[model samples]
Structure formats: structure tokens, C-alpha cells
Target: MTGNPAPAAAYKGPLPRATPETQPFWDGAKAHKLMLPWCEDCGQAHFYPRALCPHCHSVRLAWRQASGRGKVHTFVINHKAARGFEDKVPYVIAVIELEEGPRMMSNLVMDETPTPENVHVEMPVAVVFDDVTPEVTLPKFRPVR
Candidate 1:
């Protein structure tokens, strides 16, 4: 409702650019799913996709859809927003270790604002999406059952 009529979403204020290597990930988001590149040769998953696998340096990576289950590995609760993300002044940014073993950095959401000591290394989490742009969805997290 920012009267200019650009149809901008509230949560996804400004999104970063996506390259060819990241196209697959964005595509999955459109389906309300999270897809990550897995190294079929080495049996591992990784984020920030690249043509070559980070583990074995294998070029034979494949795109696998994830169940989006994970645990918070570490985090920092930001009381002040950064850059264009000022809308989200107070938030928790965390590194989550997915069930499939990929570690991704994302935001943590819940009823109350988080504090560093309130988060733990192995707190169960699940994926949530913030459809910032029409073509892009940013992955966020919430506590799990």
C-alpha cells in the first residue's frame, strides 16, 4: 500500500540478483518448495550454488528438492536493520543445518523477537518463504514441531 502503485511486497523490500547457478533454487521457491544442489558423487548438499561441487569438486551435481527441515546452528539477533532492509529492524539471522546436511544462512521468525542466548545450536526449525519479488522467494525459518 505504498501509494506509488508499484505493487511491492512488504517483506521482500529489495531482492538481490540471481544468476544461472541460482535459477534452479528460485524456480523451486515459486512452487513453495526449497531446492538445493546436491553432489551425487560425494553425497553432500551445499548452498550458494556453483557449477562445481564444493565438496568433491565434481561437476556432476544435481538439483534435489528438500523437505526444508533443519536446526539452527548459530545466529545473531539484529536490533538495527542494515541497508534497504531497514523495514526488518529487529530480526534473527541464523545459519541452519538442514537435515540433508547443507548449511544455509537465513532469517528466523517467531511470535517474539529473538535474543542470542534464546537460540541454541540444535534448535529444530522449518522453512518459510518470503515472496519478495514476483519471480523470487527468499527462504526464512521458524520453530518446528
Candidate 2:
């Protein structure tokens, strides 16, 4: 099968309320790119779209395109999901350690059933864009071929 699955139903998930600081990030996602905040002072990358660098507390922040390659640092098999996720039972919620040295929390999309036996720590993953809506395309991770 192609890497993409059936289209999701109109993004029932809670859409991000984009502020000025986070609008660029959402815009990048809509374009199927991972844009991260980089600090000019310390020359490091960070997540969560903050104005200040978490490492050096510097206001010199810039947006850069990420490689979209990371490993599953940690994850949980969520047996129960919230409103928009009820249809996807037993899904994975994982923290990925991007090659750029920043960790981002996102969903894990597997080819087959996701079990503890198949999903492991530090498993290599790649980004796949799921266009939940016309304006929002989420970046989910899947095992690398």
C-alpha cells in the first residue's frame, strides 16, 4: 500500500489555536514541512514554539526546516483515546528525538497492529503527513523501511 491511509474525517481533533509565535509552525505543517525554532545565541533547536530558547533563555529565535527523521524516544499504547481519537483505539502516543536534538510529542502510525512487542524504544521512524483538514496536516511518525 502507499504510505498514506484513508483520509481522516475533517480533523475532529482539537485544532491548534495559532498565535503569532506558533503560526509559522502550523503554516509549515500545512505545507508538509517540519519547522522548528532555533536559537541564534546558543545555536540549538527547540520544540513547542516558544519565544525564548529553552536552553539558553535567549530571544534570538529563528525558524528552520527539520530533517523529519527521528527515533522513538519513548511511547505508550493508548488504549483509551479522547474525543477525536476514539476511532483509533490502541494508538501510540510517542516522543520522538529528532536528529536536530529536539524531542516532539506526536502520534505513531504503524503499518500493522501496534503492540509492545513491535514498538520499541529508540526505534527509527520517519515523518508522514496526514492532512486532517485543508488547513491542518499533522506530522505523524512510522517505522522506517
Candidate 3:
């Protein structure tokens, strides 16, 4: 299947639960924007939003708009299906190193069949949003053409 898969009715897969620290990130995704928590003290960006900066251990954090551009740091092709991913076997799960300097794990959606030849380390990618539900949107990546 090319591009993003069609949204299923009553999505049976896992969904992210927004916490107080992560609400902004989810809000940004819902708006089709990639936002990251930036440490005001060390000027570093981080994912999996938390109360303190992972780099400098500072409480001074702010939300910043990310370029949504990154490179595949590493990845794996999943042959075994997860709870809601049976139809999507052989999909790629990648750790994307964002240009802003933090790495995040997300699904790498491809326009073609996923394989070792199609996906590799250092592959350039960009973010795409999947509105699985009215309340939740997922940030996935696609190869940058």
C-alpha cells in the first residue's frame, strides 16, 4: 500500500495517552505541527516530553516548533504483527534523529513496500501526521524525496 493506510473505524491499536507534560506535543500533532520540548538553559531539544531536560537536568523547558526533518538513526522491519498491526507486518520502526537534536521512535511510513533496500540508516525523512481519532493524532515519518 502506498502512502498512509486508511484510518480504520474504531481503531483497535494502541493510542497515546496525553499527560500534563506531553499535552503540548499532542496538541501540536493534532494541528499538523511537530513540536518538541526545548531546554532553555542548554538549548537542546528532547522527545517523550518530561518535566526536566534530559541533557542539562533543568526545569526550564519550552515548546518549540520543530523542522519535522530528521534522519533514520536506526530501524528494524517487524515481521511479527503487534496487537493492532497484523495487516501492517513488515513495517519499519525507526529511531529518527531530528535535526533539532533529539531522537524519537516512530513508525516509518513508506510510499512503497518496506525492506532493507528501501530503508536504511541515515535515510532522510520528514514527519507526517495520522489522525487516527478525533482526539489523537500520531506523528509518523516518510522518506524525503
Per lDDT, what order, best first? 3, 2, 1
lDDT of 3 at 46: 89
Candidate 3 lDDT over 30-107, as tens digits, reads: 999999999999998888899999899999999989999999999999999889888778899999999998899999
lDDT of 1 at 40: 83
Q: What does the lDDT read for residue 114 in candidate 1?
A: 75
lDDT of 2 at 22: 89
Candidate 2: the clashing residue pairs are none
Q: All candidates' TM-scores?
A: 0.86, 0.92, 0.93
User: In candidate 1, which residue pairs clash?
Assistant: none
Residue 9 shift from truth in candidate 3, angstroms? 2.1
* Model 1 per-residue lDDT tens digits across residues 24-139: 88888767789999998998888878998988999888998898999999888888778766766688889999998889999887766676666777899999886666767678
Task: Name the TM-score of candidate 2.
Answer: 0.92
Q: After superposition, how far is residue 73 of candidate 3 from its true place, in Å?
A: 0.4
Whole-model lDDT, model 3: 0.89
